[model samples]
Target: MSEFEWLKRAHAYDEADAEDLEGRVIAALRTVYDPEIPVNIYDLGLVYALDLDEDAGRVDLRMTLTAPGCPVAQTFPGTVEEAVRSVRGVDDVHVELVWEPPWSRDRMSDAARLQLGML
Candidate 1:
């Protein structure tokens, strides 16, 4: 293939592959539960971002707790890291705690709201 054609094909494949990796990362995150909440972190609106480097099997995640002073504050990030690392093809996980645009009920998924009886 010409360089132009190769670049085009690679770009398309990267988008699709990135999406698939992101899906898997989200799935893994959904399996993580907040110590005080029945809902998983993903649905609870705690996850602010999930960035994947599929070729490197690395994931860069940004998340937060319901509150800055949450009882599990010190351990939650580690928990999330372990959960994401457990997913197949995810060789490395970086979980960052973000307070910007702090988490709120409005951020929760509709299903999470219903489950929490807020709906």
Candidate 2:
């Protein structure tokens, strides 16, 4: 295949002409750590969903904290929103905190469980 074709395959989102910007989203997500935990919020299982709107250059996230009464409830959503907004291609970010399904230890990423030595 040609170099241009390879480039498209490497970075282009199947839905768009622009580069897939998910990496930037993850990079920014790494900067947000749970206030009471040592792990990045992403690994903590706090983030339940991430949707990138290629056409709009927007990102939306649905997440939960360890507990419904988590002390950082207010701050956590703000932090994640800020992180997402910092990504270069992100035109806007909206973080929603949900407690309906709740958060549990099982939700944690392997890395998070390992960091906490729960492995």
Candidate 3:
């Protein structure tokens, strides 16, 4: 094969690997629960975005809490970072707390809503 074809294959492999890594990272996030809520962070819809840099083995998570004055506000971000860092291939994790759109009950997953009896 030509060099360009080889590079294309390598890039495709990296993208697939990135996708798998993203699934693992999400699974890790699912293990983290909100101190006051019974639901895991992922199902709770607190996570706004998940970005992975496979080349650097870095994961960036953008999230928010149910409310601004949540009691675990100080520690929640750290908890998320720790969870993501525990993933097998994650070299670094950055958790950013955003409040731009704010969190609402409607943001939660249907399962989460059902669990809380909202549905």
Candidate 4:
């Protein structure tokens, strides 16, 4: 293959790898839950942003709690980081707690709403 074609193919492979890693990271996030809620964090829509660098095996996540005064606020980010770090390909995990948008029932996924009887 020409050099240009080879570069394109490599880029495609990298994208696919990144996507796969993102999926796994999301799955890991789903395994974490708020102590006060039965639903997973992912379904709760607390996870605002996920930046995964597959090549570096690093994941940067921005999330928020349902309430600022929620009891776990102090340690929740660490819990989230640990969960994400448990993923096979994740060598580094950083969890950032954000309250800018603030979490609300509206942020919850439909599934979460249904599970919580909000639907």
Candidate 5:
């Protein structure tokens, strides 16, 4: 098989693979939970945006903590970046925190809702 074949195999990650990968990445994210919250940040409505930079094998993530004054604000960003870096194929992980819109319970994923018994 040629290098192109391998590239093709990966360049366009199928939906199932993408979902699997997202799940895996989120699982890794779960390992680093908020110090003040019972739930992992992944499901805590903190992760607001994600951009898969496939060509660079990097993932750019945008998120916000439950509160700006939260105690782990400094440590959590590094933790989030590291968590994403553990995912296979992600050469670099950039987790940026945005506060314009602010974080709220509505942003939580359905899985998170179930975990909190909100759904």
Candidate 6:
């Protein structure tokens, strides 16, 4: 599916199984950290979107790094893909790195801000 379609479908996860899997996927996402950041990518506002298809056992994720030139940019998506694929019910994972809209501190979670002393 197109990235926009995946993003639009992400909010339609209403099935109980889908919710459970989504939660697991989010938990899995929380385990991945930016090499230069102390906080996980999720809290750091790096994850732009997540679409999970329970029936297909697939996950489509959109994320970004702190900067386009970050050293791990080339390999970070693969790392995220591996993390999502490790979830029990997930059989396929596609991680897309997006620079459009660009990351800013405003996207960060309150907890992340507090942790980083930005709050």
Best by TM-score: 6
- Model 6 C-alpha lDDT per residue in residues 1-119, reported as the tens digit of each score: 85434433443342223448888787667767789989989999999999989999999999999999999999889878877776768899999999988999899999999999989
Off by over 4 Å in 4: 1-19
Segments of candidate 6 deviating more than 4 angstroms: 1-19
Which run of 10 residues does model 1 get worst, by summed lDDT?
Answer: 4-13
TM-score of each: 0.81, 0.79, 0.82, 0.82, 0.73, 0.83
37, model 3: CA deviation in Å? 1.2
lDDT for 26 (candidate 4): 72
Ten-residue region with minimum lDDT total, candidate 2 = 6-15
Clashes of each: 0, 0, 0, 0, 0, 0
lDDT of 2 at 45: 79
Poorest stretch of ten by lDDT in candidate 4? 4-13
Which candidate number would show the highest lDDT if scored against the true structure?
6
lDDT to native, each model: 0.79, 0.74, 0.80, 0.80, 0.71, 0.81
Task: List where candidate 1 sits over 4 angstroms from the true fold.
Answer: 1-19
**Tens-digit per-residue lDDT, 91-113, candidate 2:** 88989999968788887889999
Residue lDDT tens for model 3, 6-101: 433433433445458887777677767888899988999999999999789999999999999998888889878876776667899999999879
Q: How would you encode candidate 5's per-residue C-alpha lDDT over 4-116 as one tens digit per residue?
A: 34333432434225455565565566555667867888778788887776668778888898888988888778877866775666788888888869888888879878887
Name the weakest run of 10 consecutive residues (lDDT summed) in model 3.
Answer: 4-13
Q: How well does model 4 score by local distance difference test?
A: 0.80
Q: Mark the 10 consecutive residues where model 5 has the least summed lDDT.
A: 7-16
Write down the TM-score for model 6: 0.83
Q: Candidate 3: lDDT of 58?
A: 100
TM-score of structure candidate 3: 0.82
Candidate 1 residue lDDT tens string, 1-119 = 85334433434433444447777667667767788889988999999988889899999999999889898888778878876776657799999998898888888999998998999
